[model samples]
Target: MGKIVISSNVTLDGVVQDPDGAEGFALGGWFHRFAGSKDLEDWAARETAELLGVDALLLGRRTSEWFESRLRPGGGAEARVSPEWADRMNSIPKYVVSSTPEPPRWNNTTVLNGDAVKEISELERTVAGEILVYGSYQLVRTLLEQNLADELRLVVFPVVLGTGLRIFDETGGKPLRLVDTRQMGDGLAFHTYEFVRG
Candidate 1:
């Protein structure tokens, strides 16, 4: 079975929406303004390593559009991810959960246009490594609600946007076991949690 890893950079208030300030949210680009020292480099390195290990990606339509525009060749002037991370994003198989197939013209991307949980469940049986997730807030909530997420790796930045779309919003409050926690230099903290299933 494959592990589903939900990775994101969130604020102190759990706001994950438009961290890059793309969606015109009031608190958009909140994540980049944090004045961190060495933590930012470490966080990028860790994400690159994680991407190297993953076999596939599961993304919602919005996130899919973001990645397709940024990660593909000749794109990404705003949020230029590292070349190593970009390689994995472009090379790995991406199963995007969307309402239409006309979008996200990135290579090696497959659109899953039906029930997300059911499709992801079926996908788990076919992959051996990680089914990595990034910036898919609604999908993350569903995964947590249905007890499907295996691990959550959050890079918590030092900022609190008190009123934006939260990552844990409306999530059906599931307990999780802390697998690992570390200081990524500066004030940033990296936390890994595994979903607890009884």
Candidate 2:
């Protein structure tokens, strides 16, 4: 089976929303504001390089909306990715799990609005390399409930958001095994964990 990897930039309190200042929320831009040190940038670049191994990207509706509004115009987060990085991203396929989206405008993107497991399984059979999930709290919750995710990669920033969307809000208990952990100079800690199945 193909591996399903999830990569996210979360706050110390697990908040993952508006890390890039796309939203007007005063609390939304924590990732860039508090974590823009050279050490953090270098670490993020390294992580981005590693995450590029995925054959495709899986995003949730909200994230897709935010990205589309800002990045699609060739500004904000989109601008952050250099031409080289953009070229690499454009080459990979993207699957957006959304119900209200009217198709994706980005190149090589597919909008999915059905059973998450079924769709992801189909993609796994056809796509090469790993399938990476980003900024989809809802999708990630479902994947965890269905026990579909193979690996979880979290980049925890040093700052704390008192309130926001969290990645581990799912009920019940799902066990995980730590595969690796590293501390970057920017005070961001990278944690890789594998779900421990029964």
| Best candidate (score: TM-score) | 1
Question: Candidate 1: how many backbone clashes?
Answer: 1
Q: Residue by residue across 1-198, what tens digits does model 1's lDDT show?
A: 999999998998788888878789977997768846477778788888988988999998888887777765667533546777887788899998887757558888888888878988998889899999998888888888888889999898899878888878887558888999998878888899998888
**Error in Å for residue 178 of model 1:** 0.6
Maximum-lDDT candidate: 1
Tens-digit lDDT string for candidate 2 (1-198): 577898888988888878877667678888767775775767657666865666778888777666566555555656466555656666677888887748677778898887778997787777767888877888898888888888988888888889887888764597889999988775778899998888
| Inter-residue clash pairs, candidate 1 | 21-29
**Alpha carbon deviation, residue 163, candidate 1 (Å):** 1.2
Estimated TM-score for each candidate:
0.93, 0.87
Q: How does residue 128 of candidate 1 score in lDDT?
A: 92
State candidate 2's TM-score: 0.87
